[model samples]
Target: MVGLLLVVTLLTYIIPAGQYARDTAGNILTDDQFSYLDEQTPVSILDMLMLLMDGLIS
Candidate 1:
């Protein structure tokens, strides 16, 4: 499981992040507003650990 997480983390760094502009209501993507995000926010190991612990409690 740890190995898979590491692989996914590496992949995230390699892949560029992106986002779509939402509509006025903020519930829909209006037209072709798809765009790359201004920055890359990769998942941290601590974040992953927190998620794992959250899953345990759930």
Candidate 2:
């Protein structure tokens, strides 16, 4: 399981970042406005753990 987590952590660096276009209403627009970001944001193990905890709590 630790190895799997390590692999997933590494894959986050390989994946390109992206975002959905938001309108004036501050809501995500599902139009053809989806685009990849110029920079890559890699996920840290602590962040992954925090997300996991949030999921479990919710």
Tell me the TM-score of each prediction against the true structure.
Answer: 0.63, 0.54
**Tens digits of per-residue lDDT for model 2 on 22-53?**
88898767677889988788989889888778
Residue pairs in clash, model 1 = none
Model 1 ranges off by over 4 Å: 1-3
Which candidate number has the best TM-score? 1
> Alpha-carbon error at 5 in model 2, in Å?
3.7
**Tens-digit lDDT track for model 1 on 1-58?**
8899878877777889998899889999877887898889887778877878899999
Q: What are the clash counts of all predictions, listed in order?
A: 0, 0
Candidates in order have lDDT scores of 0.85, 0.84
Off by over 4 Å in 2: 1-3, 19-34
